[model samples]
Target: MSANKGFETKVPENEGMDSGYMSGLVSELASGPLSEPISEVGSDSGKRISVSVEEEQLDSGLDLQISEQLSNLSFKDVTPTTQPLLVDLEEHKPSIIPQLDRLFMQDDDGDTQLHIASVHGCQKSVSTLIKVCPQRAWMDVSNDYGHTALHLAVLSGHDVVTRMLVLAGASLDVRDVSGRTPLHLAVEARDERCIKSLVIPSPNTPREKMVRILNMRDYTGQTCVHYAARAGRFDIIHLLVNCGADILAGEGLAGWTALHMAARAGDAALARAILDKYGAAAAARDFAGRSPRRLAARTAAAPAFAAHRRDDTDTDSDSEDDYDSESDEQESLFEKLVQLNNPINVV
Candidate 1:
C-alpha cells in the first residue's frame, strides 16, 4: 500500500512465471475470489434472463386475452357508426328528453328518420320510432320520390318493417311519383310477406279501406291485382281476389281487367285461374269491346282456353247423357209397374 495518491501498489516479480499461474491469476481477477460458486452464478443469470422472457410472454398473453375479449364483446347496428334510434316508450324509460320531435327532422331528400330506418331494415329503430312517434300521420311522411316509409319498406323488401308501419296505421293509399300505392309496389316487388303484411286485417283499417287499397289504380290505371296478373303471379292474383279486388273491374282507357292483362301477356295459367275464379271475367268486355276470351284467342293462351271449353263441353254432354238414361229407366220401370198392376186382365 502506498500513502501517496499517485503511487501504485507493487508486487515482487516471480522468476518462475508459469503459464498456469498466470492463467489462475487472470481467472481470480475476472471473478472475485469471494464470489459464489460458478454454477450458482450462472444459474442466477439464466434465471434473470428467463424471468425477462417470461415477463414479455406474460404481457403478450395478457394482450392477446384482452384482444379476444374485445372481439367477443364487439357489437354492430344496422349501420356500424350510427347509434340506435329513439327509446321505446313502453319499454325503457328514457333518461333524456323524448326525441319525438327529432323523428320528424327531414333530410334534403325529405326523408324522415322513420323513412330512413324503414328502408334500412332497422327493426329496432323502426319499433322505437313507431312507439315514440308523436302522431300516426307523421308515419306517412314522404320523401322527394313521394314514397312513404311504408312504400320504401315494402320496396326494400323489409316486410317486418312494412308490417309494423301498417299496424301503426300508415296509409297504404299514398301514391308515389310513379302513381303506385304501397300495395302496388308490394305486388311489383313480388314480396309475398310484404303483400300479406299490407293486406292483413287490422282494426285501424276497415274492410272497405283494404278493398279500396287493393283495387286502387295507379297512374297506369293498373291495380295491385293487375300488377300481379301482368307479372303472372297467379297466387298473388288469387290473394288479391280473395282480399276483395274486383277482377271484373276495368282499368285505364282500355278498361281492361286483370284477366285482360293476363290474356295479353299470354299467361295461360293465370288466364285460366282468373276465368275459373270469376267466370264473368271471361265474358267481361274491355273499352275496345274485346273480352279476355277474345284477347286470349290471339295470344298463346288460346289452346288453354280451347282445352278448358272442351272439358266443359264434355262434362255437359256427360250430364245430359246421364239425365236421358235415368229418364228412360224411370219410364220403363213405370210401364212395367202399370202392366203388373193390370196383370189379371192381360194374362
Candidate 2:
C-alpha cells in the first residue's frame, strides 16, 4: 500500500496556538506513515486553480453525461443513498395538463395564478381563501355582474356556493346593494333547487316555534311569493304557498294581495285557485276601490253578467204601473199651469 501522507499545515503565531510543542510534534508524526491521505482541499485564501475553457467544458459535459446515465437507470440499479434524492427530483417535476385542469377546475374560477383566483364560480377558491386570506377575498373578489362572489353565486342560482359560504360561517342575511337576499335572488331566478337548499331547520327550537326563516321580503316589501305572482309562475306560487307564504300578505305600490295580483294579471285559473284555497277574505282592495272581484270583472264579465241576471227578474211590475199613474197626474198639473198662462182659453 502507498504510504499514508498528510500535508503539513502551518498556523501563524497570531492565530493563537495553545499547545505549541505537542501540536508541532503531532504534525511531524502526521506527515509520516500512519496518517490519512487527503483527496481534495480548499481554502478561503485568494488562490486560482489552473483550468482551460476546453477542460471546463469537458468536465461539464462529463457531469451531464453521468446525470443522464443515472436518470436512465432503474430504481433497482440505484443505490439506497441516491434513491431518496432521485425521488425528490422526480417529485418536483411539473404536474400534467389534465391534472392542472382538474386542480383549477375544482376551484370555481379555474384560475392557476393566485392573484386571479378570486372570482364568482370559484367557490372552492373563495372558500379556501376565506380561511387562508379572508381580508383579501372580502375586499377583492367580484363576479361578472359587478357583485361580490357571494352575491354572484346567490343571484346566479348556485346553491352549493351559497351553502359553502354559509357553512364557512358567512353572514346569512347579507344583502347586496339592491337590498335583496339570497332568497330573493333565488325567487327572482325561479331556482327551486337553491331555495330548497336554504330551508334549514332552526337549532334546538320547538317545532311549533320554528317559523320559516327564508322567503322573506326584500326592500320592496315583496316576498318571494309576490315575485312568483308577478311572474305568473303558478308552480313557484304553489311552492311558496306550501313553504308558508301568507296568501293575504300585501306588497308593492298598491299593496296588492296574491289574489289581487292574479286577478289583475287576468290569470283566471290562478285567481280561482287562490280564492278557492285561501278564501275571498284574502282579496285586497286597491286605492281605486277595486277588489279582486271588481278587477276580475273588468277582465272577465261572466261573474258581473251573472250578478245582473240574478237581479233583473226580481223587480215588481206594479212599480211600473204606479210610475205611469204618477206621470198622468203630472200631465194634468202641467195643463192647468198652461191654462193660467192663457185666460181666454181658461173661460
Candidate 3:
C-alpha cells in the first residue's frame, strides 16, 4: 500500500546468468600455488648474508637503485693492528673523520662497515662508526638484502647493538628483503631485550606510531605475535599484548591465527593466555575451517597439561593416544567453554 515495498526486482541482462559457472571462474582465478619455498630466516651465527635473486627482483625503484650503488663499494674487516686507519677514528677529530668515510667497505653482501659491527655485536665499533661515518651512513644505507644495520643487530641477537641503534635514531619499523620488521625478527630470535628496544618509542617518536608498529604484519600476513607464538616466547607475548597487540588479529600463514600456531606448538599455557584475554579466538576458524578448540584438542601437550594438573608431576608423554580413548561424553565441559567464549551466546 505504501510503495510496493514487497515487490522484488531483477536486472534484465542477468536473467539467465549461471551462478555456478561464475563461482567456478572466481575459484579458478583465486586458486594458485605459492611461489617461494619455506626457509628459515635470521641466522644465530650472525654471519654475512646474501639475498635471493627473486627477493632482489621484488624490490623496485629506489631500493633497486641503492642496491646498484652499493654493489661497487667493498670493505674488508681489518684486525686492530692491521689497520691504523680504523683506530685513528676513535679520536673523532674533524680532519681525519671525513677521510674515514672514503674507506667505507660495502662488504660483498652490500653491508657498510656499520652493518658488520652491528651484526658482530661490537658496540664500540658501532659507536665509532656512528661518530666517524658521514651522518647518513650509520642508519640510512641498507644492504643488498634491504636490511639496515639495526635489522642486522636485532636479528643477530645483539641487544647492546640493538639498543644503541635505537638510541642513535635508527628506524624502529624498517623491513628486510623478506618484508619482516625488526620486531618480527626479534620475536623469532626470542630475545626479549631486543624486542623491548624496538617496541619502546624513541624520544622523538610518537606513542601512537609505536602502537601501529605493534600490530604490523610481514609479507606472509603474520604479525609479531605470530612469530612470538611460534617461538613460545611467553615474555615477548606478554610484552606485545600489553603494548597494544590485538589478540583477535587473525592474519598469518594460510589465515592461521596466533592461537592456531600456539596450540599446534604444544604451548597450552600461552594458548590459554590468549584465550583468557581474547576469548573470541576460541571460536575463530582458520583456512581449514577448524576453530582453536578443535585445534587445541589435537595437541599432545593439551593432554599432558591436563595430566599435570591432575597430579603435581612431570608429564613427558610423547603420544596423545590416551586422550583419544576418552568418550565424547568427556567433551561437555569443552563445549560449554566454547559457548561461554562466544560473546554472542553469553547471557
Candidate 4:
C-alpha cells in the first residue's frame, strides 16, 4: 500500500470528474492489492482504473457508500481489473418514494414518483410514495398531459396501484389535460379491476359523491357508461349502471347517449342491458335525432341480424314477416337486438 505519493494524477483545471470524488476513490484503491491491472481503454485517454475491493464483502455502511459510488460512476470508470466486482443491485434500487426527488432518473413528462410507479404497476412504491411524499405532490403533481398518479394507474390497468393511490389520498376525480378522470380512463381502458377500484369505494368507507363520481363527464361530455358501451364491455357498463351512471347520458362530442354507442357497435347485450335496466334509453335519440335502433340498423351487425331474421323466416313467421303492415315495423325493430354473438351475460 502506498501513500498520496505516486497515485496522485492531477485532474485538469477546467471541469470533469468531481475532484474530491476522484481523489477519494483513488485513495481508497491505494489500500488494495498492488498487482491489480489498470484498464487498458483508459490508457489512451488518461482514464485510470484503481478500485479492487470485494463488493460483496463490504458491510452495510460500505454497501451504501459503494451504492452511491455506483450511482455516480459509469462502468468505464469503475471496472475492476483482475476480476469483476458485482455490486448488490438491491442496495442501489430506489426503495423510498420520496428519494425520487433526489434521483437522477426523472420520469418522462415530469411525472412525479407516484405517477411513474403507478404507470409501471409498482404497487409498493406507489403506496409508500403516497403516504410519505408531500401532500401537495399527490394533490397537484401531474405530467405534461396533466395526468396524475391516479389517472396513469387506471389507464395502465394497475388495479392495486390505483386503489392504493386513492386510499392514500390521491384525488379520485382528478382530471387530465384532456379533462378525463380516473374513472373515464378506467372505462376507456376497459379494466374491470381499475374501474371497480375507482368507482367502488373501499368497504366501511363512506362513498364518494356518487352522482359526481359515476356521472362525471369528460371534456367530450361522455361518461364512463358511454366508454363502456363503445368498448363493448358489458360488465363495465353494468358496473357503471349499478353505480347510477345514466344510460341515456349525452356525449359531448356527438351528443350520443350510451345506448347510441352500444347500438353503433351493435352490441346487443349492452343494448339489451340498457333496455332491460332502463327502458327509456332504448328509444332515446342522439344529437342527430337518430334513435339507437336506427343507429343499430346502420351497423354491419344489424344487417347480419336482419339477414338472420330473413333466413329463419321459413320456420317461424315472426313479426318481421308481418312487416308488410306499418304496425309491425316497431315489433320488427325490437327483434334486431339479439346479436352477431352474445358475449355479454345479460339476464
Candidate 5:
C-alpha cells in the first residue's frame, strides 16, 4: 500500500511537441473562455453587419419622428412668396414656418413683396398675397420712402392693382415721404383709372372717408383737385368734384384754391369749370387778397376771357354800343373789382 503503486504517471497527448510549449498553451486557454482574440473579433464580418443594422434602425426612427412633427403643423401654400421681378416663384414650392411673415419681409429699401408685385402689375401674385395675408395692415406696409403698396400701385399706373389694394382695405390717407398720398400721386400721374379707383367710394371705404382723403393736402398744401386743376385736367376736375373733392379747400401757403391754381396756370377751361361748379371758390381770396378773377387778369387767361366776352356781344345793332362800352369797362376793372361789389364775375 504505497502512493507510487496507486497513481501511475500520465504522459502528454501530443508526444511529438515540447512539454514547455504544451504547458504554456494549456495555461493560456485556462486563463479565459475559448473565444476569438480582440483583433479577430474586430475583423468578424457578422459583427460588422449587426452594427450597421443598428445604425440604420436608429436613423430611420429619427426620420419618422421628424415627419410626424411636420404632419402636425399647419402648412400654407406660399409658392408665390417672392419678388416677381427677380424670381419666378410660381415654380418653386419651398415650405416655411409661419409663412405670412415671409410675405411681409422687406428688402433693402423696405419694400415688401406686395410692393414689388404691385409695382410690376403682377396681379396674380398680388391676389395670392392678399388672399393669404393675415392682416390688412400688412398691405399698408411702407417702403423707405414711406410709399405703401397702394402708393406704388398708383405711381406705377396699375389701375387693377390700385383697385385691388383699395378693396383690400389699404388706407388712402397714408402719405409718402413727399407728403403725397396715393390719390395725389394718381392725379399727378394723370392716371384716370387709378384716380377713379382711389376716389370712388366702396364698401370698405365710405363716402365720408373718401371726402376726408379728397381734402387731404400734400406737404405743398395741394390736394388732388389742386393738382388736377394745375394740369388742366378738366375731366379729372369734374370727376373729382362729382366724387366729393373739396374744390373750395385752399392749398397750404398762399391759401390758393383749385380755382386759383387754374387761373394762375392760365387754364380758362379749368377755371371756368371750377367757377361754374363751386361759385364761392371764385370769391375765395388768397393770402394776398387776390381773388381767382384777379389772378386771371395777369395770365393768358385774360385774353381768353376778353375773347369770350366778345363772343357774347349782342347780335342786335341797337345794343352793340352798350355791349362794347360795358366790355371795355369790365376789362379795365377786372383785377380791381372785388366780389363784394361786382357780384361774382367768374373768369
Candidate 6:
C-alpha cells in the first residue's frame, strides 16, 4: 500500500539489475533535484533495496560495464602475450653494426689498428680512421708479416672495406715493407673480389697508374699479376691482361712473369689463356732464364707446355724480328759514335 509498493522488486544479492531499469534510473538521477537524501530499503522477503542508492549503484555498475566495453574496444588484435600496455619501454640489445676501436692500440708485436681492423672485420673503425686520422691510418700500419691495411683486407676478403680504403685515398701503389701492394695481397688471399676492386681504375688514378700498381714489384720483385698466377687465380690473370698489365713483366731475383708463376703453380688453363691472348711473349724468360713453357714442361702440365709449341715457334719468329730491329739500331748507334769520335777522318 505504500507509494512504491507496486514498484517493489526483489534486488537479488550479488546480482546486477537489467539494462532498461538501469538506464531509467540514470535518466531520473540526471533530471532530479540535487542534495536529495540517498537511502536503502528492504522488502519483507529480505531482498535489499534503496530508492536513490539503487540508482547510484546501478550508475556505478553501468559505468563499470561501459568502462569494460571501452577497454575491450581499445585493445588491439595483435596484442603481445607478455606485459601490460605501455607507451615506451627500455630494452637491452646488442648492436647490429660493429663498433670500431682506436687505430693504433699497442699490442705485443706493434700490430697496427689497420691490422686489427682487417683481422676482426672492423669496417667501421677502419672507415673512421680513414676519415678522421688518415695519416695515422697510413703510418707504418702493418701486420706481423709486415702486410699493410690493404694487404690485411685482401687477406681477410673484406672487399667493401678494401674499396673504402682505396677510395679514401689509401695508396694503391704503396707496398708493404716487403714491397707487396694490396693487389699482391689479393693474389695471396686468392680473393677475386679484392683483386677486381683493386684493379678497377679510380677517378683520381689514371690507367697508367693502375697498370703501374699491377706491375709493382714486392721486395721479392714479384708483380701483382705474378702473385695472382702463383695463387692459381686464372680469372685475375685474365683481368690483369685485359687491364693492359705487361704480359712479359717479371720481377724478383728469379724474374718470374705471371705466366711463369702460373706454370709453376701448375695452372695449365691460366698458362694457356695467357699465351693464347697475349701471345708467347708472356711466357718468355724470367731472371732465371726459364720460359713459362719450360717451367710447365717440368711440372705436371707438360701436356699444356707441348700444346704451346706452335705458339713458341711464332714467338721465335717475333724474337728474330726484334733481334733484327735491335741489330739495325746498334749499327746506327755505332756509326754515329765513330763519326763523333773521329771527325778528322771526314777532313
Clashing pairs in 1: none
List ranges where model 5 is wrong by over 4 Å. Answer: 1-97, 303-347
State the RMSD for candidate 5: 32.5
Listed in order, each prediction's TM-score against the native is 0.61, 0.45, 0.56, 0.55, 0.60, 0.53
Q: For each candidate, how many residue pairs have backbone atoms clashing (under 3 Å)?
A: 0, 3, 1, 1, 0, 3
- Which model is ahead, 2 or 4, in terms of lDDT? 4
For model 6, residues 201-243, the per-residue Cα lDDT tens digits are 5543457787777777766556767677666766777777777
lDDT of each: 0.59, 0.41, 0.54, 0.51, 0.59, 0.51
* Poorest stretch of ten by lDDT in candidate 1: 49-58
What stretches of model 3 exceed 4 Å from their correct place? 1-100, 103-105, 132-138, 287-289, 301-347
Model 1 residue 338 CA deviation (Å) reads 72
Clashing pairs in 4: 220-252
Model 6: how far residue 139 lies from native, Å? 6.2
Q: Model 4, residue 260: displacement in angstroms?
A: 1.4
Query: The CA-based lDDT of model 2 is what?
Result: 0.41
Q: Ranking by TM-score, best first? A: 1, 5, 3, 4, 6, 2
Error of 4 at 168 (Å): 1.1
Model 5 clash pairs? none
lDDT of 2 by residue, 1-347 (tens): 00011332221223333222123322222232112221222223533222111111111111111223222322122221211000001111122222222322322432222212222233333333333221223322332223444454555455555544433334335455445665667677787665654433222211222133344566556677777777777777776666566667776445667766676567766666665566642335654444555445445522432232222322322222334555445434433532353323533
| lDDT (Cα, tens digit) per residue for candidate 1, span 41-75 | 12213331111111111111111111222112211
The collision pairs in model 6 are 103-113, 179-218, 221-252
**Each prediction's Cα RMSD?**
35.3, 33.3, 22.6, 20.1, 32.5, 32.5
Where is the poorest 10-residue window by lDDT in model 3? 80-89
TM-score of 5: 0.60
